[model samples]
Every structure is written in C-alpha cells, then in structure tokens.
Target: MTDAAIAPRRPWAYAIFLVVFGAAGWWAAFQLTLDKFLVLEKGKNAVLNCNISPFVQCGTNLQSWQGSAFGFPNPILGLGGFAAVIAVGVTLLAGARLARWYWWLFNLGVAGALVFTIWLIVQSAFVLGTLCPWCGLVYLVMFPLFWVVTLRNAATGEFGSRLTRIGGILLPYAAPIAIVCLIAVGLIFQLRLDVLHHLAA
Candidate 1:
C-alpha cells in the first residue's frame, strides 16, 4: 500500500504547493523572458547581469539556436505556460475540483513541460555548455508539479482505477525519482565539463 492510500487525503496540500510553485515558476519565467528580449535588442553589446560567471551564465543559452526553437525565445513560452499553471493553481486553491477532461488536459500540458525541461537541461549541460539560473529554478519547480498532477490524476481516476492504484503506489517514489533525475543531471554535467575547474573559476 502506498502512503497516499493510507495517508489522509489532504487536497489542500497539492493546492498549496501548486499556488506557491506556480507563482514562483511564473516569476522566474517572466524575468527570463524580459532578459531574453533585452539581450536580443542590444545584441553583443548587452552586458546581461545574468552572466555572472563563465560557467554560471545565461547568455550562452539565450544566444543558442535552441533558445529560440520556435523562432521566438523559449522563455516566452515559459511565461505563458507558467501563467496558466498559476491560474489553475488559483482555481484549485478556491476549492474548485477540476473536471476529468480538465485534469486530462492539465496532465498533457505537464507532460509536455516535463519533456521540454529535459530537452533544455540536456541542451544547457551538453550543447550550450551554460546554465541559466532562472531556467534552473523553473526546472526545479516543474518536477514536483508534474509528479503531483500525475498522482492526482491517478487518485481521481482520470486514468482509470488500475492506474489510480498505481499512482497511489507511486507517490512514495516521487521524491526518490526526482532525486535520481537530479543526480543524472549532475552526472551529465560532471562528465561533459571540467566541474572542479569551473567551480574554482
């Protein structure tokens, strides 16, 4: 039996996290979007404050082709998407139970976000070879958001009873899963870059 099954159902728990992280994610995305625009307008002459150090830089990712995969800065999408999350969170906090279809749609959106974040993480660590501080913050917020949504869907039977049972069973594993993902991300960076040198610099 999963902790979720035996543990008391606290709907507010997820709602509260949704509100907190949703707001935070939006704030980070908004800042990144603005900085991206500023960088584009000024070009090479722009001395981005986010360019704190060689390894701890945002410009490298901003200037990369992947940054504008859809011909506009990715942060623009982040701004919009994170805003949607905030709105949904607000609704959830209001004691509104979203519809099954809405839950399905929300899960789809979060799944896309998960995939998108992973792609950007890879691009930053391997391709671009730089990490955007704001983007990193968004990635950190996304994991639990995605996990909670998935578990909620299962609990509520959006994916059927069997999946709901599985979701409850999976609840205890969420933190471990997230930790493994972070470990993998760190490993990728350590393998691809001179981590000790970059840290010392």
Candidate 2:
C-alpha cells in the first residue's frame, strides 16, 4: 500500500468500541477458559457458578465437542484475538496511521472471527440447545466489532474501488441493521429454545 493511502483519521466511535468491547470479550473468554479448566479437572459433574440455568449455562457448552473443535478450548483464540484488537485500538486512538495492507489483514482476521462466531452461534442454538452466557457476551461485542471493521475497510477501498462506494451507502444503515439483528437474535432464541417453557419449567 502506498504511503499516500495510509489510514485516514481514526473513526473515534469504532476506536472506542474496539477498546471497550475488546476488553469485555477478553474478560468473557478468560472466564470461560477458567470455567472449562475447572470442568476438565473436576469433571462435568462439578458444580459451576456460571451454570445459571439449563438454557443459560457454560458447563454444557464447555463439555461439548463444538467447544473444542480444534482440540483446544476456543477461548484461547479469543485471548489472542481480543488482545490484538485492544492493541490496535490503542494505536489508532493514539494517532497512529496504518497502511492499506494492514487494514486488509485486519479485515481478514475479523472475517475469520465472524465465521467461527457464527458457527458457535449455530451450535449453541440448534445442536447444544443451550447458551453460554459468557459466549453470549463475546457475540454481543463481536457483532459491531465485525461490522465496523468491514465498513472501515470497505471505506478505505480495501476490498476494491467498487466496495469503497458501497461502504459509504452501508455506513448510514449500520445502526438500523444492528437493531434488526438484535431483534432477530431475540426472536431466534425464543423460537429455538422455547425460552418461555424453560422458564416455566
């Protein structure tokens, strides 16, 4: 990337989000990792404080194959990923300008995280039939994290010149789209988990 294309003025909003939610995601992942270790050492029968309910619990998730698809607990990835985000966010806020290639690489990482996160979401909903509260927090933070990264990258013509124009259109709609996504998550949780029935049970 040409030095001429160095990152523009940091979007203070996303910069702030990257700091705040990056920390939140890191904390949630750390908690989940600790809880997973406890489960592993003591076994599934171990009572865990994070086990809030049959539907809202981390134990069920930690014990599942989906939680360790790579032969390790997934939060290990979160530990590194969130830390990188925090570091980058601090740099941006400190008036550092990154090259276009850096933004491309950053978006690639965000895309990968988005894919894995969506898979986790599916497993939690359709397969495990349960939810990890900490995982939920990660997802909550990740949603905007991914969107902002995409929009910023697109704005900078990271994908291509065409997407640069498209990004401008998308920027205005981000808020409404996020609201719709939140409602969709709620509706899906209600439908898939029969949340009301679980509460009554």
Best by lDDT: 2
Query: For residues 80-142, what per-residue lDDT tens digits would candidate 2 score against the true structure?
Result: 999999988898898787888898888889789978988898899999988678898887877
For candidate 1, the TM-score is 0.88
- The lDDT per prediction is 0.81, 0.84
**Pairs in steric clash, model 1:** none
lDDT value for candidate 1? 0.81
| C-alpha TM-score for every candidate | 0.88, 0.89
Candidate 1: residue 147 lDDT (0-100): 83
List ranges where model 2 is wrong by over 4 Å: 1-10, 196-201
Residue lDDT tens for model 1, 1-201: 996577644477777777888888888888888788888899867788777778777888888899898898888888888888888878876757677899899899989998989999989988888777788788788887888788868977898888978888887787778777777777777787755577678
